[model samples]
Target: MKIKRAFIGLSVLCAIMLCSCSRTPGGIAPAGSPNGQASSQLPTATPASGSSDLSQSSRPDASTATSPAKPPALTQESIQIKLKQMTANEKIGQMVLAGIDGTTMNAQTKALIQDYQAGGIIFYKVNLANTRQATELINSLKDTNSRNSTPLWLSLDEEGGRVSRLPDELHKFPTNAVIGQANNEKFSFAAGSTIGLELRAYGLNMDFAPVLDINSNPNNPVIGNRSFGANAKVVSRLGVQTMNGLQSQSIVSVVKHFPGHGDTSIDSHIDLPVVQHDLNRLRSLELVPFAEAIKNKADAVMVAHILLPKIDATNPASFSKTIITGILRKELGFQGLVISDDMTMGAIATNYELGEAAVKAVLAGVDVILVGHEYEKEVKVILALRQAVKDKRISMDQLNTSVTRILTLKSKYGISDQKITEPNVAKLNAEVDKVMKLIQ
Candidate 1:
């Protein structure tokens, strides 16, 4: 009887040891072949806090488990310190991307840069003569702000289909529609890179190309071929690819007409176009491309002057706090620059005074106030923005945020290796020819 009891006790001890070896310390089965079944399919007991068996993803209560810590690359602390050192005028100036009358640096252009201390300059067809003249003209404009820490954003709408400010002497690239029709994102990227190389060669840092708008509506006036395609997925893929290509060549790619200008028949240049779609409709179709661009770290986004009644009925997107701040910045998670469409456009300029529009834009979370084709209006915009700040209408924090983004962009792509001189048109044209081969 004593021998039998000792054997029975040893058997029980072995059973306990085997059971314990199969389970984790928390009394849960190990994460594989629990009960001879796949661990993934079998529901297991919740792991206790600080349990080694639980993976970072499996821990329900862990804060750092679901999301890993992101590096502080674009920290606001350094930008905030720089913002504090800037003068009120400098802050206001950084918010303006002004347009000049002539290709050559005339007195008006001089004042816009030297006196007004404008942050950027956008060139138009009237400002272009030839490649050589364009290069010389851009160089002269750049020289005005050589002393300033942030160089002016020498930009132009070279979207390559219907919109192009580069003289005809330069090789012409295909439109977004042609690229989109190819149904290959690599082609779009090549197009952007080819155009970017030519633009950079001319000493132009910013190219307002790769229009993110979807060509959903065939009858749309201003953005037909300028858009990628009618499909949101295609637009999203091509837009991001093109933007990446432009930025790769050190060109500041400014994707334009945000919140979808594809379906609008009425051009904002003539009058304010309104979108009656609710937030759901926009998210499904229009906002898709913009979201992708934001996800891919686009350098800048230009807000449209159109109004979305469901989003913000009172103000156009460029001047709507609900759209820019609440939607674009907060919901969409776009931390880069938010540039306003030309304030002189008939959408806002015809409906509201330029000065008031500028103030409203700043308050609405616009970083750069684009006053194209009107120097007087640009001056008024600068003054009104400054006055708004002084009167506590626009917070200093808001102003700082805009200036910080502008400064950050300038710091990244502002410095060019190409000297500001007469550009080699033959070499640039040769590069453009090679880039155009993708579409051919």
Candidate 2:
């Protein structure tokens, strides 16, 4: 797999450009400030039932020099120009990551790309029947979406253990815990590269892997073995190596469950997990690996649904501008794509309607919202975003910033001059077997 030559031109074009940045409207107020509220200058947003209103949330002070320096703009030619060319529906489509019903390109799949113009497609186990079928399906999705000249991300949650979506015919390696236990950074790099090689062979680009969440809580239901280890230092070191390995093979690595999911006892998929730790505690532990991933220039970071009440009480991190924009974008200074954890998950879906959740996420500074499964709900999200943009509820500046990052990532890793090729199951499995030995 190789980076499309066309994207190299964009690299130079955006070299001098910078990502959109500013203090989120109302920066975080000081401790013991009146009512423990955000600055009065910030716009007030009423939180949903059982949600914290934006004004009531505790946000970081953007003025402090504690935040890292900002990264370069992900695009050139002003993403606004691209936005202007697109219809409101098209722009809305750019924000969605749609899921297909099956491994084949049926009518629903065709409608999603051709009609909906979805910016990306995420595959689950139900969509990977066999090597040939999966390859053809991915190519078909790409071909159909290419009609508009905008590439789509063929993504999957392939974290190499229980999280991997590929069938048994494809290789499956040890979990993150096993890899970390090996204590060899080189092995971790090889594991990530091997996964990338298999994904690339099938024409997929984006991989949501290298779970950056530190396994700090042993009782955590979802992240147990999936995490690298309980040590933040080990996770940071191994996570960066894995990210490098994936990008090295042209597979965009999305370091995930941002701000840390490993410490929570409840799974976000079933219920909202609240991390009671204050910002200082997060910086000391859970946030360490993510900071390292950002420092390594991770291509994308997947924000979790967990709420950090100590930081922002009213909204989950995925729906908080204070967390996404103020902290993730401004404080950490990540210029790469910021994708939301699946919107269909319980933490979000149970609390907010599809349209409401989709709108809030975009407004909160997310680039891509993954509406996995349920086409009806997916359509609702698209229409909601379209309506929001048309009504001016979602600003052009916000849309431009997100679409630029999405397009830049696509331009950088989504494009490929090569055609879909058959994966080497033997070679891939062999690598996994050898790597498994080290961990075993």
Candidate 3:
């Protein structure tokens, strides 16, 4: 009777071991099995606090089970996966950067986020009242976009001096000209970093600033104080420093009016400004700062509405393939985002229809169209882009390429739809004061 009992006990122990070996840990099905979609179906559990035994924790009998390894975030493969998941409208929406109408969330602005799926919003003085109001407005916008697949680029022309957009509460720093006048790389970088910190405190991700344009034309209306100064080397060095400063604080610095807007006598905002400089002049003078910024890995470039008769006679730089694709992309080897200046501006609106201009801008290799005014015009541009895709005026390959660049940039900056907390005005101002002293 004792021998038989020992035999049965040994057999039961063997059976138990077989069952344990057959069952997969964490209830995950074996690979290629009918229920083996572990990546999507399985729930990952965390080990208990202070638990140090990873091997024991991974045991089938443990209270918590480890998760399968996930693919690295924001990889090229990962971005491509996301790109494949997006719809046509979603892709087109990522190419637009619209303007909001008020200081608070309005119905029209809400639609732009929810219905139109605009990729970004540029704030003007009218959209901001105070630091608290601006933070709340930005947070609300971010909250509303929480359901979006991608984050919005809350941006503005915070170039300081006359182009300043921050409310009365924030410390207004000197313009690019003042920083350029100082001609100190360290000061320029600190100035950019402070501006970036200020923008961050308000939850802004993009600044259309650190004007790379050289102030070659004293009589130039729009870019006089905005430019860093008339010297190419100084502009190049300081512009790049400022660009690096903003980038250091995780703010995207979009070096603007590419191919040089410094020498134009007229404002592109009011009308098409014509630059008579040829390729050689542009390379030597106008393109110097931009080229320097590009070398330092600039995130985005805002194309100007100025027309270079020598480069492309029929089209402005914003809608010329030769300028955007050939000059900026091919010749300069810029692999970053290409943003067009607001299409609703006088330069574009006065000449081409809003819809047609947007389409042409995309065809010219512009990635994001800034429609900074009018809900009707913004909607028109989006619809026009959609129709263009359908009619093949903008091919799917081309559309995907632009959207890929946009997503890659957004990912690179670690942009999120998650709302940020209200800024600490006192604390931020104290930080800005330190930077102010450096430049002063």
Estimate, for each residue in 166-281, the C-alpha lDDT of model 2 and write its tens digit: 86796588788888888777667767766776776677778999899888889999999999999999999889878876775667899988878988988999889988998889
Model 1 segments more than 4 A misplaced: 1-78, 416-419
Instruction: Please state every model's RMSD to the true fold in angstroms.
Output: 20.4, 15.0, 13.8
Candidate 1: give the clashing pairs.
none
Taking all chains together, each candidate's TM-score versus the true structure is: 0.81, 0.81, 0.83
Per-residue lDDT, model 3, residue 111, is 95
Quick one: best TM-score, which candidate? Answer: 3
The models' CA-based lDDT, in order, is 0.72, 0.72, 0.76
Better of 1 and 3 by lDDT: 3
> Which stretches of candidate 2 lie above 4 Å from their native place?
1-75, 78-83, 414-418, 434-440
* Candidate 2 lowest-lDDT run of ten: 42-51
Q: Report the poorest 10 consecutive residues by lDDT, candidate 1.
A: 38-47
